[model samples]
Target: MGRRTPKKKSREIYNAWNQTCWIKGVTVNPMVTLEYNEWWSRRVNDNISRPNLEEARSIEEYLRVVPSELEIIKQDFKKKTSELEKKIEQLEEENVYLKLDVDL
Candidate 1:
């Protein structure tokens, strides 16, 4: 493997933070975001001082800012759908958008 340049490393850290830490549709608290980013910076940066330290530090800013987005989504889904909702009259409907929130 080849060594990554400083700018490349910075961009990679920034991209990783954005992709992994962002929870959509929620207002993140500033203090919490700061703490989260600090933790992530320590983990990824490992005390290595560099020109693009800001991007690496930014990765930890996400800390489930909405409490529990998944739980809320699940509860809402269950409230809206019932046992009778499982039935579909059109057999072909099964072939389209088939997804199992089910696991075996």
Candidate 2:
């Protein structure tokens, strides 16, 4: 009987802890729901106003993204690489001609 009593008491404590955990886990705030509902209704019902012509910007200006310093450096490097490649090709052609002239 004594052993049974301890087991029953432990079971009751476990049930109570589980109940508290279940209650804490559920978020049932009616105030937050009401505020969100009100905001949603206002957003859905409100009229969208047109932009003022005086302050309106062109789509191209609004969408244009400025290149960063890294991007500018990459472009310069690419140009220099292409120029060096062309010079290498020219030197190789001259070497081939010089080799042919020596053979003849």
Candidate 3:
């Protein structure tokens, strides 16, 4: 008979769930964020000094910057949506004039 694998401890499962919640909410503490940023900077600086580097370092940097990048994207999306709404309103006004011209 094959032996059964052991199940994960309840504490480990709870910690994993808690980490998921924190990540989903982007709820990292400011001090933790600063420390992570510093660690990333040091890693990037060290990679720059290397003779040849893989694409992984760039990917790592992207991961490090993702939260700020996501905020910029969100702002840009709102700006674009506002501009689109204005354009849509203008088009509706133009359509009304075209309908009046047809009716006449």
Candidate 4:
């Protein structure tokens, strides 16, 4: 009988470790996911093995910009809501005046 090679033993150990990891509900780290996605995108874009620092920097900038943009949108919504409420109140007062005129 032939003996298993060290590479085969290592493969078996790796498989066992993966199985145990799944059974224990161990998850892939979010940083690992982000790194892997960035690496994969870089590979697809330039056929390169390393992440693109420029692209990563741009993504960081976009993340920073998003909150300020969201704040502007929220403020606009609040202003519109207040304007609508004032219009509603004015219409209600007019309605009450019309009802009194009709009753008289």
Output the number of the lDDT-best candidate. 2
In candidate 3, position 3 carries an lDDT of 48
Error of 3 at 54 (Å): 38
- How many Å off is the CA of 98 in candidate 3? 0.4
For each candidate, give its TM-score against the true structure. Answer: 0.21, 0.44, 0.36, 0.36
Relative to the unseen true structure, what is the Cα RMSD of model 1? 27.7
Each prediction's total of clashing residue pairs, residues at least 3 apart in sequence or on different chains, is 2, 0, 0, 0
Q: Go through the candidates in order and give each one's C-alpha lDDT.
A: 0.68, 0.88, 0.82, 0.85
After superposition, which runs of candidate 1 have C-alpha atoms over 4 Å from their true positions?
24-104
Work out how many backbone clashes candidate 3 has: 0
lDDT of 4 by residue, 1-104 (tens): 98999999999999999998886665555336777889888879886567767666665667774558888999999999999999999999999999999999
Clashing pairs in 2: none
Instruction: State the local distance difference test value for candidate 4.
Output: 0.85
**After superposition on all CA atoms, what RMSD does each candidate show versus the true structure?**
27.7, 12.2, 21.5, 16.4
Lowest lDDT sum, 10 consecutive residues, model 2, at 23-32
Q: Pick the candidate with the highest TM-score.
A: 2
Candidate 3 has which clashing residue pairs, if any? none
